[model samples]
Target: MKKQSYGMKWLSVEVVVILVGLLFLAPFYFVLTNSFKGFAELLVDTSGLPKSLSWDNYARAWEVLNFPRAFLNSLLITLFSALCMVVAASMAAYRLLRHPSRINRVLFSLFVAAMVVPFQAIMIPLVQVGNWLQFLNSIPGIIFCYTGLGVSFSIFLYHGFMKSIPLEVEEAAVMDGCNPYGIFWRIVFPLLKPMTITVIVLQSLWMWNDFLLPLLVLQKPELQTIQLATNTLFGQYLKQWDLALAALVMGIVPILTFFLVLQKHVIQGITAGAVKG
Candidate 1:
């Protein structure tokens, strides 16, 4: 009777979880289904599926948004920023570990503190600095901004994960005549793979989806990221709902596909990162 009772409890939990999952997925269903609909049909019944599957909205959005260019811009910015953040954060974290100092403590504390300080607090000053540095309206400009914004949290994650790494392995590598650089790249970095993947996934998502920073930095339409391009569909008076929805669906598909592909790695990375922190 106890065994049967446990089985029934587990089944109930599973059913509840399935229902919640469907509930969360409901918005995605509406967006996807309505993306195929005309403005009129969508207004009539958004909850219902499209009367007829049509790619008209998608085609219009694609042309107006200049999806190809925006996609390339977003991809470049995300990949570059993610790569830089991973390398710089991992190295900074490792160095702090290797050479523990009062300064290192202060630095780590600053990084941690920065995580709590909202971006809005610093955005105005950041923009001023960017302008002074001549980093405005350029890909390199926004990439630099992303690096600064992402690096703090990345360092925190890497630092925590670094704590779980056995120091003796690095010591062994050093004793074998490996220089500091070689010791880090060859021995230590490979071990940081899980956390590194986590950082990459996180930074990529942030940079790819980020609109505000890119908007402030890259003002030119030619250099617009996907988010910026999508925002153009929203006029002051009349919003293009069909085009906007289609663009949203388009934007969502790429990241969703990316996450699905690397979801296992992401899960493993998060688990491994949490184990140390």
Candidate 2:
């Protein structure tokens, strides 16, 4: 009787887990299915499967959104932003960990505290500052903002992972006459892969899907990222559901592929803090 009860409890838990997962995936199903339907069909039957799948919407949206240009813009922004955060955070965290001076400690605390400061609180000031610095309305400008916003959390993650790496590794490098730059670039930085991949994946997803920041920083249609290009489908009066959904699906695919490829490293990153090098 006890064993049977335990088996039933486990089965119940599995059922609940599957249900919750499907609940989360419901939006994806809606978006994908609706993307295949005509705009009228979508409005008529949102819950039902499309009568037939058609690539017509994809074709139209691709040209309308200028997927190639928007994709290139998004790719550049995400790539550069992620790289800047990884490099800056990794180096800063290494300094904080290895040096442990009073000022460094205080700076580390400030970084942690900054993580809790909502972007909304600084949005207006950020715009003013960016304008003053001539850092608005360009891809590089947005990358700069993303780096500043992302650095705090990235440093925190690197700080944890850096703890797993032994100090003796750097000591040996020092004895071998490896300069500080060489020690960091060659020895320490390679050991940071798991967390590095994690930061890249997380930040890439955010910058790729993010609409608001790009909308603010990139006003020129020529500078539009995929999210902003997709937004063009919605006007003051009419929202082109078919084209919009298709563009959304197109926008989702590349980043989805990126995450799937690097997901193992993401898992490793999550567990890195518990295990030592």
Candidate 3:
């Protein structure tokens, strides 16, 4: 009777979880169905599928949003920032682990503390510094900003994961006549694959979806990221829902495709990284 009761409880929990998942996905379902719709048909019945499949909305939105340029801009910023963030944080973490000191502990504490400090509190000072440095409205400027903001969290993750890695392997590499740089890049960095993939996935999502920072830094039309370009579709009184929904769908597809392609790696990375330090 106890075994039967436990099985019944498990089934109920699974049903509830499936229902919640469906509820969370309802918005995406609406976006997908309405993206192919005309303005008239969308207003008539948003809950239903489009009367007929159409590409007009997507084509128009693509041209207006300058999809190619926006996509390229987002891609560059995300890739550059993630690469720098991973390399710097991983190295820093490895160094702290290999040679722990009072100063190193204090610095790691500061990085962890900085993560809880709200970005809003630093926005004004950050913008002021950016202006003074003439870093406003530039790709390199925003990429720099993303790297700074992402470093703390990335370091924290790396520090924990690196602790879990046995130090004996690194010591063996040193005995084999590997230099410090060679030991880190060829031996240590490769072993950090799981955490590196985790950091890349997390940072890419933030950098790609980030709107406010890009909005502040990128004023030129040519430099606008995908989110900024999409914002242009909104007006004070009227919204181009048909075009807006189409743009949203287009925006989601690329990231969705990215996640789908790397999903196995993402899962493995997160699972492995979660193993205790």
Candidate 1 lands at a TM-score of 0.96
Q: In candidate 3, which residue pairs clash?
A: none
| Local error of candidate 3 at residue 82 (angstroms) | 0.7
Superposed model 3: Cα runs more than 4 Å off: none
Cα TM-score per model: 0.96, 0.97, 0.97
Q: How close is candidate 3 to the true structure, as a TM-score?
A: 0.97
Off by over 4 Å in 1: none
Candidate 1 lDDT score at position 251: 91
Residue-level lDDT of model 3, residues 1-277, one tens digit each, is 9999999999999999999999999999999999999998999999997888999999999898999999999999999999999988999988877788999999999999999998889888888899998878998998899999999999988887777678789889989999999999998899888789888988898889899899888899999898988898899998898988888888788878887787787787767767775
The 10-residue segment of model 1 with minimum total lDDT is 268-277
**Tens digits of per-residue lDDT for model 1, 1-277:** 9999999999999999999999999999988998999999989998998889999999999999999999999999999999989889999998886788999999989999989999899999999999999999999888888999989999988887888878889889888899999988999899988888888887787788888899889989999999999999888998888998999999988988887788788787777667652
Q: List per-prediction Cα lDDT, in the order shown.
A: 0.89, 0.93, 0.89
Tens digits of per-residue lDDT, candidate 2, 44-134, equal 9999999997999999999999999999999999999999999899999999988889999999999999999998899889998999989
Worst 10 residues of 2 by lDDT: 268-277
Better of 1 and 3 by TM-score: 3
